[model samples]
Target: MNDITISNNPDRERFEVSVAGKVIGKAWYKAYDGDGQAERIFYHTVVNEEYAGQGLAGRLAKAALDETVAAGLGIVPVCPFIKSYITGHPEYEASTVAITPAHLQFLDKALAARA
Candidate 1:
């Protein structure tokens, strides 16, 4: 397995995963203020097609969520990929917030389609 490097690009509001100096995946998020606290809303996650099925997306998602937690920010997993990931990994649940019923519905459909 290639050594993947995950880094936060604050200017772009995204976390990126790179292998051999080439970007293979990214998780985009937006930062906002809510209830007198900082929050992060993950909206999209993408791994390069060539890098698909290599676990890059999961690595990127973990890195992004870890960063959010480190920053003391709540998370809203609007992105289906992220929602699905967090569902399987409940350890990150403490940092998650603002997940609506619609998000769960989307995740259920997405999970079913994947199955």
Candidate 2:
């Protein structure tokens, strides 16, 4: 509920949201493999630690998702937070790549093996 500003930089193809001139959140996305798959984007993200728990990340995600929908792109949420957010918000479900429990198990195993 703060004075947040959201901007979509077409040149960079990312949407940014800031608070008081400080960038607190962002959604990075692009056309998949230069294919005209504008209806599908790969995402990477982070929310400022100071701004965590304020729902700022969700707000930013929502804005980006809305933009992606407007642009007709399905979402490939590579960020864990974004993936979790989609699970809770069914509105974005259709645009998401389903990450089942099996996927988590595999990821955990892969990470542990590397450690």
Per TM-score, the best of the predicted structures is 1
Winner by lDDT:
1
Clash pairs detected, candidate 2? 39-72, 39-73, 39-74
lDDT of 2 by residue, 79-103 (tens): 6777777888889887665544544
Q: Report clashes for each candidate as comma-separated counts.
A: 0, 3
Q: In model 1, which regions exceed 4 Å deviation?
A: 100-115
Candidate 1 at 36: error in angstroms?
0.7
Q: Residue by residue across 1-115, what tens digits does model 1's lDDT show?
A: 6578999999888899999888888898767665687778788899999989988899899889988999899988888999999999998899899766654555566557656
Q: lDDT of each structure?
A: 0.84, 0.69
Model 1 TM-score on a 0 to 1 scale: 0.82
RMSD to the hidden true structure, all candidates: 6.9, 6.2
In model 2, which range of ten residues has the least summed lDDT?
33-42
lDDT, residue 26, model 1? 89
- TM-scores for the candidates: 0.82, 0.71
